[model samples]
Target: YLDVDLSLDQVHLYLCEYLRMKDLEGPYNAELVPVVTKAHRSDAVPSLTQHELDAILFEVTEANENPEYPAVAVLFQYDAAVAHNALGVTGKAQWGVLAGYDRERQLARIIDANAKAFGRSWSVTCEWLLQAITGYGYIVMRHVGRLLRRQSVRGSASM
Candidate 1:
């Protein structure tokens, strides 16, 4: 239903959300680093102000349970790539390039799992239908109302 033209970058953002959900990473959240808007030389690394750095550190620190060396280090690397525009190319390609694929697999798994769950009761189907309908325009709403009413009549007759 969303008709906006999503660039590869925007698609990456959706992928991030999908990966986080599939990983069951409850506390994990990612925000695009503002550095993406800045013009930078190909060889220059993106820089963050102290506050941005602190916020990122806070997220990772909070995510850590034991704060052991390797765990913190890995967490730091993950967040750092996102916080800087370092997610662009080669030397940092493992973080950025790989995230795209990781997110794709995670999204596919979630879609598959959701499709399986959709084979459920009529209550679920109705709930989903209602939620979707409510997001539409007034003219669409009238059609949805008539459809629901017809469905209700048919449902009662079957009972």
Candidate 2:
């Protein structure tokens, strides 16, 4: 069983397989787009190159049928604030999700799943990402793909 704060790598692996199954069903396919390091994050400034970032943006933006917006999220480790907005765990290296951007305020929008535990402590400067990340790991920018099919098949029969 996965703890609430499951490691991002494990979650990503499960998701990639699930999406691959969906793609094989001949409805929709959301392939892994960005190339990143296979190892766990240890780098201080995990980042996405301009070309990769642009490609993700273009693909997501092109999907006019997307419900809320693009299905992409930026995952990285950080020195999360230990005060009230910690990532629901102490002692563990903090991680956060880059969901959206606020051009006006100039901040990378952070939307952690444990938002309730930490409150809505979102929005950090691009500079914070550059300087605060834990290591020099490559960024894992992912698109949480859509299933053109009906509901999610979540049990033993899902595959």
Candidate 3:
């Protein structure tokens, strides 16, 4: 209906590239992570669970106290409304962010583009949120101070 329909992979890359470009942006660059998928993967896929997400976030938070990529968020792909169970789109592959959580309150906030429930962000019970989300893997966003040179050592040797 619009112009051209894009696959999830394309969408993911677009998002990643967008963030990379945002590195030129002012404040957003200070805390941005680019790329949405593994170079060899086509889709993010459902590979994680709610509990796993919680653990990852907790670790990221703890690390951010003094480490790299201080900010990390989960992008969930599910078949429910971004905000409430009865407020927006459903029965489709909708995406949203698990901005953060409150273990004490047992709540997780969902930030969405089609949000209308809680003014672009919705706070729902973790149980409900987990039940409604799919793993689909999300990129751990961060602020890169400089280019990172990665290394590879294989062939069963330290090299």
Model 1 lDDT per residue over 26-102, tens place? 43333333232123345544343323333323333333345342122110112212222234422221111110112
lDDT to native, each model: 0.26, 0.45, 0.48
Q: Please state the error at residue 101 of candidate 1 in Å.
A: 26
2 or 3, greater by lDDT: 3
The candidate maximizing TM-score is 3
lDDT of 1: 0.26
1 versus 2: better TM-score goes to = 2
Pitting candidate 2 against candidate 3, the one with the higher TM-score is 3
The parts of candidate 2 lying over 4 Å away from their true place are 1-5, 24-71, 82-89, 136-159
Sorted on TM-score, highest at the top, how do the candidates line up? 3, 2, 1
Q: Model 3, which residues run further than 4 Å from truth? A: 1-7, 24-46, 59-70, 81-83, 86-89, 116-118, 135-137, 144-159
Worst 10 residues of 1 by lDDT: 136-145
